[model samples]
Target: MKRISVLAAMACLAACDKSGFNYDNIIDDGGSLQYSLLDSLQVQMRTVQLDSIRTSGTGTGLVGSYADPLFGKFTSSSSFRLGLPSETDPGLKAIYDSVELVLQPDGHYYGDTLPLQRFQVYQLSRPLVLPKDYDAFYSHQQFPVNDQPLADVTQRIRPTSGNKVHLRMNQQFGLELFEKIRSKSDDIKNEEYWRDYFKGLTIRGVDNSAAFRLLMNDTAVVMRIHYHIVKETVEEKTIDFHMNLSELQFNSYSYDRSGTPIAGLTPGADGIMGETTGNRTFIQPLTGAVTRIDFPSIAALKELGRYGRIMQAELVIKPDNGTIKNYPVPPRLTLTLADKKNVVTQGDTISNAAGVQYGNLVTDKLYPENNQYSWDLTEYCRAMMAADEYNYRGLLLAAPFSEFHTQLNRLVVGDGGSKQYRAQLKIYYLLYE
Candidate 1:
């Protein structure tokens, strides 16, 4: 937020205006704010901080927020009505505002040059369960359709009753779904050319139930649907794992591939990394609002079982917008020094510098075809936060959050000037015993 003295400094800096207050001939967009010699004087400006953070809980964690300011000034009896709905919590507040002097010569049309008030408002709701009162919430509700502008190819899902275990997969991701069926035998084992299978491919009825079943071919081969999303919402659902295969072992892991656009894994590293090795992992979150936001959030996931033995799983969904309110995050985010040297001169270039370094800092997407993002090394980016003064270990995961976006803030500004500046935010979580 700009302080009072800063506002004065701004006015003085622009005092270089000739016709009126040209202050270096201000022109951010295509046009400029100028003055003529025959107009009176006036100024309007404001600065504000959101009052308090709003919070809600789910399982054992919470999420919260920041502030947004509102201000304006006009010559007449101004009457501007605001339309912000305060459905929940204390009404919003106007942090600061003021109107003042522009005394100057006549014929010199003049006006104020104050940075407008702007902030992101948020409401953290109680963290919800996967199948809790789901029916009551979305029973009659219909999701507003914004059809996929581009449809992805459907993976050819083959199901052979015996031979291997198969799992169904989401079509948006174009990876081949492999079913590990009965390994090998004497008779027709030589025909293992992409183990052929049968699948009931109809787009109606108890979709998954009719499809995600175990089947075997005469040659003793099996197929499985890796995973499936049957119900849009459920009051009670379970993920039945083949207790025999699972070792009943659940591991904590973080998304560390070079392609994800998370907060802490850019050209450096942060807390989310699992020991620079593959074993350490972080649990993916699934919350109600977030479930409704992302395609594969926890609430939207359902793992079918053998004899209906549901595997235990928990999910927390977060808002798609990049902020760490209810989620445990540092009061403020301070990024590690970006390499700056590996800057890209073009987008499609696949040179050594183009692979990982440039992807995280310059683009939200890395593996665009698969909708994969880039990650920022949270600890390195926020090395300053680890000091004794900050003390953010278990309380905060200390990783960066990412979102898929098309407009690259880099291209819009280039070397000419910076246009819109945004940061890779933090994603926090705690996997309990």
Candidate 2:
């Protein structure tokens, strides 16, 4: 009897229409689905321009040059003052053997080692005296040099191989300097006097084929004068001249971005729109070419209605593959807030703990499929929401430690458009209403 009743009930239920079993007919409790109640979010992308970064005395022990087919050429040179070790001189009977400049490698370069280059040392015509305390030196400074070089070499060099380079100097010039020291001339008495006689020295790259880096600290770089004092016995002695740590020393750089996409745009000014700039932009340490970005519509997020709080904010940048051939990717990129005057301000929350900081770009990783980087802008967005007076006018992107270098690594990024690769913003928030 029970089996017959169960079959009769199943037959009746199956006979009902599909609407009788619809889940949508149940009463809905709305708390779990409250996400749908929040106001819609908004994202906007703005065009940027290229600004020129100030390149001056960077204290890093790096100097080199590399030619890029797209960006043209880059060159680096080191300039500093060399002075006598002491005021008192050894007695004059010593015969001068020779003078040589010794430079130790810093183990860094950006080109192939097959090509040979010419490294030449020139004597500055004027003392390297700075007018102010914090005076800056640029690559374009025009300091004259002697017609003759103290030392010159044309050979293939691998400075990153843990070796030192010794370029022999002219014996005649070495003897002349030795005589002045033996005579205890006024020129050899004090720092000022010595500087007046020998202004300074500049180690430069003359050949466009290759570039090299040298450690120029007081210990690694030296000018040695080999001589022997003759008395009853032959005692070989040597005098050393070294670079002054107190004086200004720096690498001067020059870049020729003639035929590249960067050539179509003006630099040292505001960033041009991506649409106006061919939907792409550039940043290179060698040229101090900085990319500037702005989001004019970000402030409108507050007007969208009340929200509990923002959980996070991110700015996404997509790299353009068109510029990736035949060049090493940039080691890193730095983003910072610019002031009202469009100058880089001091509010970047860049830290070591988090690889993706407030304004630091990812360097160690690159996603080939996406080829993108995301920056956390939670603090910046919060400040904007709080209506605090901020120095953050926009964002500027470039490489760090680039004040005195020609980092061959350059970057090209996409401007926002209907395309999927366009730059965009992502914000996650909660709602209380």
Model 1 spans with C-alpha error above 4 angstroms: 1-7, 14-191, 197-433
Collision count of model 2:
4
Q: Please list the residue runs of candidate 2 whose C-alpha ends up more than 4 Å from where it truly belongs after superposition.
A: 1-57, 61-64, 86-93, 132-134, 228-237, 264-268, 276-278, 305-308, 348-367, 385-392, 401-408, 418-421, 431-433
Worst lDDT run of 10 residues, candidate 2, spans 32-41
Query: lDDT of each structure?
Result: 0.18, 0.61
Candidate 2 lDDT by residue in tens digits, 289-393: 666666655565553223224556677777776767755555456667665445665553433333224333454345563766677776677656544346335
| Tens-place lDDT digits, model 1, residues 50-124 | 111111110011101111110111110000001111111111221111111101111111121122211111111
